[model samples]
Target chain A: MPKEKKIRVLIAKVGCDIHERGALTLLTTFRDEGMEAIYTGRYQTPKGVANAAVSEDVDVIALSDHTGSLPIIAEAVLAELKKLGVTDMPIIAGGLLTQEDVKVLERMGVTGNYGPGTPMDVILTHIRNVAC
Target chain B: MEVFLHNLTGIPRVDEAISLMKARNIRGLTRAISIVENYEEGRDALLNDAFQRASEACFTLGFTGAPGVGKSTLVNAVIRHYRRSGKTVGVMAVDPTSPFSGGAVLGDRIRMQEHNPDNGVYIRSLASRKALGGLSEATKYALYLYKAFGFDVIIVETLGVGQDEIDVARYVDVTTVLLVPGYGDTIQMAKAGIMEIADLFVINKSDRPGADLLKKQVQNILYMKAEKERPPVLNTIADQNEGIDDVMEAIAEVRQRKALQGQERHRKRIVEEIRSSVLTRLAGDAEPHLDEMAGKVLTLSMTPIEAAELIIRRIQKGCLEDDEKNSI
Candidate 1:
């Protein structure tokens, strides 16, 4: 019998960001939504995130940007994922984003750009929609 | 990396996976562990193949005790000590699975943040999924995977449930059961199954008042048994990073002692694994009969052991048939 697969998400803090309050807080939020969430602790590089994402076999990679490092970090992480032959693993951005930033990130192949204080219910719904 | 080329499609390539694992590719090891953990097709065969081909000689160290003993904190301390000597460490920290959500919080990763950036240390957190032993049943397989990943030391940390205390002994070469001062009933816990299996007994949080008493109780328990080289009982305040050196030395001593025993203890562990595997399979097969059996036990009509025997007899007579044990 084929066992049912659970949605596994990698909640990570990318770049040299120390503002992990959002990332740490979202750990249980994802788990409560019936998703297996693995947190990447502080000081994560894009290469490390890409490696951990591939190694952990996570379905979604959500990057929490505390600094303004997401644009470059996202591009580097996407390149690293490409190195591993991953093209469409939904790379989502959360926390402290503006409309202009969202437009730029979406144009650069990021699937979702969510802002701070976005309800977990809405976030999980979007993840389920894109992930499934 | 070349070995992972086999499982592009179809069933998981057990042989190629073994090759990739032997060469210590993190991606291959991670994917293979996922397959076994999820109980995908041929999971047991893959694990058996890898067990035979890759990791028959890796040393496993187990850390377990009752909850609130700072097991994770102590694990972080030991991992740091090992890494100082240029040894690679792989940690498997198990936490309880959420019954409502079926996902684990996995808080151990936060405590082990120091090793996150260290390439020499690899940490994987597992949820104790439906295994009565209070461990992810595939933990032993994870140990093998980590061993094959070029780690010099593999540590398996249980959720500290009493049921899983003996389970760690099946896989590890050395076991350290951590206790704290003023642990309510330390002496009573010293009489548990976990204490008997320990190669090193640790009194963590030794800064507290009852630390010496706990040590005395553990010593008394050790004295009751006959032994050649007695298992050392030591004190440590792991959170403060005090006494970690003595703990490491005790582990080294125990490793040497286990090596001296050779295959004698290994043979016994295999026997225990076989028995445990068989009984778990039997119970799984007789699941439909369990409610009635429980009712009989409640009514005092049959003992649990009798019920087990009856299940075994039924299985032997072809009355119950189930899948093979995929619990590593």
Candidate 2:
């Protein structure tokens, strides 16, 4: 019999994105789902986020992007992760991301881009699947 | 599938993590904090390595008080003060773990969100899992991690103060026990363990009616304890941002006096931690059989006192069994 595992997700903010209600919501949501959520708070740079991901030993990296500074911030974050030799860690984006932005993030090697209004159930399922 | 510590396939080895901590890389710091919090095997060795390499910084402080005393808000004010002076602060706000979920409500961070955008502050809400004294046993390790991470000040706010929650005294440089205005009389509140552990006293919500009497009682109690200098007592209406500076000033004075005394807090903390760890290990060895004893407890086969004694005896018995096995 396999024991149930607690999925550990490191939630980080990119750029100067100060709005993190979405991140906080997801933190409680993930915790309620029996996952361990480590929040990095706000105003994290790309390298900072990447460093936290590797250091916390989180199963996934979820970037909370509300900066509306497209591509550059997300691009810098992904590039940093790769540069640090974190090639295959599942990366997810949450908060106010549009369909077009999600496509951009996906193109940049993000495993999932969860936009606003994406059902909580779907996000939770995706996290569970990717974490396992 | 994993039994100990959060694991990552690509996670750097302990050496790399140490180097990163030296470089003040956020990831390395994060890794060290997580590893310590999880109580992974060889954690002491890893932490000792970090501690040996760490510079003397981040004079540790602890705030202890009853629930709903605005301790977190007071802490937030302190963070703002430190950030204004361009000093980095690492805060560990420990919350009670839900017995069912083993997760934190984490509402402490809500009061702290204002500092979220400031690069000078890092706030972590840890769930105290079965740890007594209003904090996880791992909190001391996390403080080491934070000190190595270069925070100028590391503040540990326990979930709430109770009769047995004086463990903060063993760990922090100076402990300020926060109390609201309407606590019982000085005689009522000044129990043995609680008063001695407090390096300072804060009566928050000074705007309330009973504030003066509470402050006077604390002062009188301190006056009677003639063996040492009395700890300074102050007032703060944390909600209105009132008297925050006085608290900081009081803390600064305490820190200065402690420094003049030659960093005895660190030495004391080490001895306390050693004592705590050894006892905790013995308790852990005894704890596994408590499940069976608990069944006996349910069925009236054994009284609770008997069950406790059985667990206590098992600790020594387990050690003897290991000794015999090693001899063979």
DockQ of each: 0.34, 0.18
Q: Each model's C-alpha lDDT?
A: 0.74, 0.74
Candidate 1: which pairs clash? none
lDDT by residue (B153-251, candidate 1, tens digit) is 888999866633578877789988888887656447556577677888899999989999988878877886667567899999998999999999889
Runs in model 1 with CA error above 4 Å? Answer: A1-4, A15-21, A66-69, A79-88, A129-132, B1-16, B147-150, B162-164, B226-229, B280-328
The list of candidate 2 runs beyond 4 A from truth reads A1-29, A38-102, A111-122, B1-9, B54-58, B83-88, B107-122, B147-151, B183-188, B191-196, B205-214, B226-228, B237-241, B259-268, B312-315, B324-328
Docking class of 1: acceptable
User: Cα RMSD to native, each candidate?
Assistant: 5.1, 5.9
- TM (B chain), model 2: 0.86
lDDT of 2 by residue, A56-104 (tens): 4678887777766645676887777776666778877777766788688
Pairs that clash in candidate 2: A51-B27, A55-B31
